[model samples]
Each structure stands twice: as structure tokens, then as C-alpha cells.
Target: MEPAGRFITFEGIDGAGKSSHIDTLAAAFRRLGETVTVTREPGGTPLAEKIRALLLNDAMDALTESLLVFAGRRDHLRCVIEPALARGEVVLCDRFTDATFAYQGGGRGFDAKVLSILERITQSGIALEPEKMRDPDLTIWFDLPPEMAAARLADARAPDRFESQPAEFFGRVRQGYAERASAAPQRFVRLDAGQPRDAVWSQLTGSLVQRGWLQAGTSDVGASAS
Candidate 1:
């Protein structure tokens, strides 16, 4: 029998280095001869990309913005993520619903009830489809303090609308992430973002290997050991 496709997501606030690490991991997986399909949230498919612009641009109510995000996610899963998973390819996503709980429920002061409603709407349609609604096999949360995340954003181009929120808002976002991870310990793996790049990479590879997602001694080599 073929191995089941894996859906893995890298999650964190803006500037948490998830993008960089995801790139590194994808390359590593390819070097190991693994078939991997990489993508990002808020903008994976065409429709999602347009929705992303609206979410990140200036002047939108928080509720509207959050709902738009879920809408984009629904289209993305239907068009991109679900198909790749059904084909038995590893799916590496830059963000997933965990981000919604963080940025919308925590940062924007929306209730978790709102998230549940949107999730039902977005996921219900595909919940029973072939190879559907398989929650991420692993959600790697690149845990970092709000201050550090803000500092990294500062070094980049002008902060996007979400990145421009007050420091306290981001604090709440972090708390939300913490809450989600706590609730789903089996699916969420927290990585220390305070460490150096190499150190974090080591931990990431190790987690994946321990979860039996990758071989112990492949291109990941020493990376999976540390």
C-alpha cells in the first residue's frame, strides 16, 4: 500500500522565520527524493491571493477581514491542498487555521465561537470528500515572543496591516497559539524561535523524524538527530 500523504504546516506570527525554515525543509525533503508540494496561506490559489490583498490592505473591519481569511482558506484547501494530499504528495503549508485562532480570535478580540462557525462553513463542504478534512498531520509552531517578532518585522519593509497592530494585540495572538497547542498537543509541535537558525533547524528535523515522517538518516542526516 502507498504511504498516506502528509499535511504539514508551519505557523507563527509575521517575521517568525517560518517562511525561511519551510523553504529549507522543502529543499531538504527534495534532496531526500521526497515528493513535496509547498504553499502558503491567505494566498495559495488565485482567488485566495486576491482575498489576501484585501485582508492585508488598509481599512477593513476586523470581522470582515477574518471572514475573508476563512473564505480564502476554503478555496485554497479545495483547489490546492486537498488535491496534493490525495495524490500522496507531502503538503507543506506556510500557515493554516491555527493562525486564524491566533490573529483573529486572539489578536482581534474575536470569540472562539466565531472561529468555530467559520471553520464549520469552510470545512463542512469538503469534510467527507475523498482524502478531505484531514487536519494537519503536524503543525510546527515557531514560538517567539511578540517583541522579537516585532523586531524582525521592523527590519523588513513597512509592516503590513496585521503587522502594524499594537504590541498588546500580538501578545494576545501568542496566547491564542499557546492555547491551541495546549488543546492539541498531539498535532502541534512548538519550536524555540529564540535560538539561532541552525539550532531551530535541528529541532524541526528531529521532530519530523521522531514522528516517523522521514527516515532517521537521510539528507536530513544530522539535522534529525539534534
Candidate 2:
């Protein structure tokens, strides 16, 4: 059956295991008989997927890449996310606007003002007001050091452009996420992502219970808090 809640986002850096735990949480939600729509940013919609390739592929310039991300988000919101969210489905996304702030603002040293401008331009046509934009009801930031994250990436597939950046850059991005989370404590739930998988899941579940999102039992963010 279709769900009757809005959205939830899974946030984290490259190797913080956000993807892994998203799977676990989704299954838990299903067991509770809640409908969910699992998706990700930079490519939830068809046009956005192509933009995602351009953004993640190594060839594009940083400015171009960042712009493309906003483009993808614009389309993703209009076509897939907003509709599902309007229907009150639980939208589980892998990443969202926070990634742009972390990667472009912190890692690449881009002015956040630029992002504000892009958001305004891209999202203008959508009927959803600024306050009613498809924001996650809960955001979970899996925290981990960049050094450890880089090591974890080593065993994975070929690195994306962002993943291939210098460790120092990613460290700054991590710091940015922490700062952002602190700035919006009500929306974000910070987690010590360096813990074991089982331990992390335990902490996640506890948060979900605390939030009253999960019925009986379920899974579970940070700034601009989730």
C-alpha cells in the first residue's frame, strides 16, 4: 500500500555506509507494512541520471559539476520526489542538498551564495514553495573521518571524481557536514559511523523509535536536521 508520511534522507560521506544501512532500514519499514519509495539525489529522475554521470565523471570542471548537481536535483524534485512525497510516501534518499554544500562549499571552496542562486533558478518553476520543498522529515548523517573513508573506498569500484579528490578536501567536507548539522540540530541526527555495522544499526533503530516514525519498531539524522 502507498504510505502516508513525507520524506526521510540518509546522509553521509563516501564511505560512511549510508547505502548499506539504507537497505537495512528499508527492509525494516517493509516488515512494518509501510510503503516506501527509495531513491537518491543527482539522479532520481531520468534527466537527472544523465546529469549525475556528468557530475561524477572526472572530465567536468568543478563549477560545471556543481551546477549539474543542482540541475539533477531540480528535475528529480519535480518528476519523482514531489509526487511521491505529496502522496505521503516515505521517500528514502541516499543524498540531497547537503552533499552539494559539503562537496562544493567545503571541499571545493565555492561560495554558498552561488548555491543559493542556483537553487532559486532551478526550483523556481515548481509549485512547491521554498518552505515546502521536498526536505527529509529525518536526516541521518553517518559520521566518519576522511582518512578512514578513503581506505574503505580503496576496496571498492573505480573512484568517482569526488571520491578521487585529496583526503584534505574530504576532511573539510566532513567538517562542513558536522557544522551544518550543528547549525540545524532539529533536522539532523549525527551518528558515530566508525562503529561496527551491527552497532551502527542499533543506534539507527534507536533514533527511529525516538522519532515516532516507526510503528512498533523501525529504523532511523542532522543540520538543517532531518
Candidate 3:
């Protein structure tokens, strides 16, 4: 059987505004009396965090990047994600393997076939069964045009390695996300992050309620988050 908890992932190219709504959603889930574990990829655990620093600051080849990412993912699974999951807490993760496939495989033009192998090797055994791979029950993808993304990022902060990439790279990353969504529509929902903040929050909360993860009409943004 699957874990008693649900695993949800948020995805988008940087500056697409996906991160803006994660905490609000987490609060909404908490209001519904669920135990929520909100975390991010490449930095969920100590080792993973160190890897995240290197990934965002240091330059490396695609293959090396892939290996480091998967290495971090393995530790994150064992030390953070899977455990929270096993304890029946909802896991709201910011990015996951899909980002790896997008950033490394598509953005960096790495080998997709090898990514497949790495995905399998890194994600298997989630159910304590070697063949069973872990995946989000729902993936909320914030779809925004690359041009808008660039404009949004322009004054946000000092750019990191991935954030500083050219518009062309973001386009490829967006395409990669689209491909992943296309291949798994049942597990994915596309959100227009370009929408007004309240509208986006409504859609997000509504999605969880529709899936029975949250009670209907419990859509108020918590005091702290609102």
C-alpha cells in the first residue's frame, strides 16, 4: 500500500512565482489539521544542503551535476522525505527529480536515458520494495512564459548559477516541465502563476479540497500568511 500521507511537489522555472504560494498552501493544510512537512530539494538535509550550495554557485559539467543532484536526493529520501512520509505527514516539496530532469537533462542538454537510470536508482525502494519508485501524488506546475520569468527575475536578487542562465535555457527548462506534465497529466496540474496572487491561492487550495486532502470551504489564508 502507499504511504498514509500524500506527497505533493511544486515545480516551475525560477521567477515563475511557484515559491510564493508554497507556505500559504502549507498553512492551509495545517488548518485542515494535517501534519505538513514543507521542504525543498537539493537542500533538505545537511549533505544535500552542501550539495545545493555547490550546485547553485560552482560550475560543473552536466554529468557531474547529475551525479551530485542524485546523491543529494538519495540522502534526502532516506533522511527527510521518506521518513516524514512514513510518519503520515503530508510532504509538500519544492521541486524534486522532475527538476533534475528539467534543469540537468533539458536545460543542460544532458542524456535523458541516463537521467532515467538515475531516477530509477535514486527513487526506488520508497515502499520498502526495491522496484517501487517514489513520486508525487500531485505536482503543481506554475507555468509562466520565459520572457515574463526573465522580467520577474530581473530585480529579484543577485542571480545564482541556475537563476543567471539565459532566456534560452529557461525556455528549454519550461519545455522539459511541459514534457513531464504531458507524460503524467493525472499526477500534474498546471497553474498560471502569472495570475493574481489571490487567484492563484484559490486555485491551489481548491485543488487540494477537490482531491479531499483538505476540507471544502476551508480556503481562508491563515493570519500569519495572509
Candidate 4:
């Protein structure tokens, strides 16, 4: 039987350069003869993508937003993430529950306890064990100052509801991510996003190598996977 696959997630506030590097990591896995499945939270399955649209465009209350995201997460897990992992294909997710905690719980002042409960329910099904919930084996958090992240977003595409929030809101979101990384240091690797693109890529690939996910001297064999 094939070995179980690794689930690696990329997370950070909007404009933190996560989207810029997720595919690079995936291509590295592919070059190593690993089947890579690149996907994202709030969307993966068709139904979940619809939910993603609603979540990004609508201005709903915090609880409502949380519920909607969890609902999408359920569909994503059942339809995409679980099956890919079962097949021993490396799953590279752009974002996951961490974003929900950062945005809704931290930025919107929603209750973390409540989010935790929902997390367990959505990822673990009927089980109440927090440990049973699906979590990334490794989460690459692109840590950047909120101001710099905002500046990056300024030149990017039109802002979504969350992206349109004030700088103070992003500050709280960054704090939320910091808390998560502190709480689960083993699963998270925080990288400075302010560095040059090549430096950021080095940090990412180096972390994967250190964790035994990649070989010591594998060269980039394909074009940019961005």
C-alpha cells in the first residue's frame, strides 16, 4: 500500500504572498515523483466554491460568516481533501481553518471557543475530540507586517469584503495567526514575507527539506507553478 500523503497548508492575511508561492512548493513535490493536489479552503468542490463567492462578497455578521465557512469546509474535506490524502497524494492547500480563526475570531471579535467547537464538528464529524479534527501536517505562514501587506494589496485586484477592512483589522488578524503558531509550533513554520521573492522561496524550500519532505539538493525542474 502507498504511504499516507502529507497535507501542507499555506496561510497568512490577504496580500501576504501566500498565493505567490503555493504552486512553487507543489511543483517541487511533483519533481520528487510525488502526486500533488493543490486546492484551497472555502472552495474546492463546486458547492464549496459557491460558498466561497458568498463569503468573500457578502457582508454578514461574524457568526454567520463563521458558519458559512465551516459549511464550505465540510464539503471541501469530504469531497476533495480526504480523498486526495487517502490516495497518498501530497495536498497543498492555499488556506484552511487558520484563516477563519484569524479573520472571524480575531478580526471580527468572534469567540475562539465557538470557532473551535465548529472546527471540531466540521473536520471531525460527530466526534467531539479536538485531536481528531483534520489539521495540516505543516502550515507555511508567510508572516508580514500588516502595513506592508496592505501596501501589497493596494496594487492588486479589486478588494473583497475582508480585504476592504481597515489596517487595524489586519493587525488583529496577524495577531491571531501569531497566537496559532505559538499554540502549535510543531505544525507551523513562520517565514518573513518582507524578504525578496527568492529569499522567501528559499525559506519555504529549506523548511520542507529540514522536515524531510524534500531532498537536500533538488533543483527546480519546471517553470514557475504560479
Index of the highest-TM-score prediction? 3
For model 2 the TM-score comes to 0.89
Better of 2 and 3 by lDDT: 3
User: Taking the candidates one at a time, how many backbone clashes does each contain?
Assistant: 0, 14, 0, 0
At residue 121, what lDDT does model 1 achieve? Answer: 76
User: Cα miss at 65, model 4 (Å)?
Assistant: 0.4
User: How do the candidates rank by lDDT, highest first?
Assistant: 3, 4, 1, 2
Shift in Å, residue 63, candidate 2 = 2.3
Misplaced by over 4 Å in model 4 are 1-3, 125-131, 219-226
The order by descending TM-score is 3, 4, 1, 2
Q: Give the residue spans of candidate 3 off by over 4 A.
A: 222-226
lDDT string for model 2 (20-131, tens) is 8776677777777777889997799889998888788858665887788988898888887777866866788999888888888788888888976776677554646544
Q: What is the per-residue lDDT of model 4 for residues 158-201, given as tens digits with 9 covering 90 to 100?
A: 99998999999999999999999999999999999998777788
Number of the top-ranking candidate, with lDDT as the measure = 3
**Which ten-residue region of model 2 has the weakest summed lDDT?**
217-226
Error of 3 at 25 (Å): 1.0
TM-score of each: 0.91, 0.89, 0.95, 0.93
